[model samples]
Target: LSMPKGYAMLGRGILTIEGVLTFCSPQLNFVQMLEDHAFGAMIKDFDALKEFRQIGNRLLGALSKSMDIPSEIADVLKMTVRGQTKINLGITEAAEPLNAVNKMVDKLVIGIIDAALLISSSLICTTDMSPKIFEIPVLGMMGYFAALVVGIWLLNGIIRKK
Candidate 1:
């Protein structure tokens, strides 16, 4: 597809994802949108407001990307007003990072549950293990595994922090 047309499609998709994010967790997603000024005004907590400002700065840096919105490839998007073009491009470009963030959030929820289960199973198996069962112990094994995961995640967090 042409660059402009592709951008239009991507822009609409971004807005759709934004709507979904708002529906799922409005508070967390308040600053996700490129032009999410309303969220900034709504937050009352000082920490939340500060976080929103940081998000705003990140978005401002990203929005500097001047993308070409797709026009005449035959679609509903080509009809967007010139004034809304920047918002459209900003939203579309932001969609990628937003989508990745959403995916990571989902994975984290699932991972937490899974890790808990593994740790629980390990504890149960180790606590209940008899001398007859000479295999490696359970709880400690799971603990090691969980610790490794946490370590990796923490390392990644540090990398991102840098």
Candidate 2:
């Protein structure tokens, strides 16, 4: 059969595995998107569950204490009633080292300045003002050069630090 317009030669047959996989590849992206959405919802649910467990522990402990039980025994009784378990609050990832943080902040600031210079230079180049270098404004050219220098400096710093 002739390949349909806009269909690649390898993707023209419904019966071929390659054709089916090629057609289905776009749908595979939706799976990742759905997984991400589901994971975020799961995290919210976990946080709510953690909060619920904490409230339950507090309420149970208060009730047990009000019954005139000794504080130590009330604690034990609370544990037993709650299935003798520990509730983990949440996962904690180790923080970046201070040096890394500082370096990131520095790079971020420099990157912003570089982007600004690039945008401003592009705008300046579009203006009718003269003192042109190859028909481009010299001021804009200077800005572009400055941005290139900043970019190189940023890269140099990153490489040296590593």
Best by lDDT: 2
Query: What TM-score does prediction 1 earn?
Result: 0.28
On TM-score, the leading prediction is: 2
lDDT of 1 by residue, 29-139 (tens): 533555567566666435876789999998887766523223343234544543333343345578789988987787677668757766775666666464323575555
TM-score, each model? 0.28, 0.42
Report lDDT (Cα) of residue 4, candidate 1. 90
Q: List, residue by residue over 114-140, the lDDT tens digit for candidate 2.
A: 999999999999998899989999999
Global lDDT of each candidate = 0.65, 0.82
Report the number of clashing residue pairs per model. Answer: 3, 0
Colliding pairs, model 2: none
**Model 2 off-target regions past 4 Å?**
1-61, 64-96
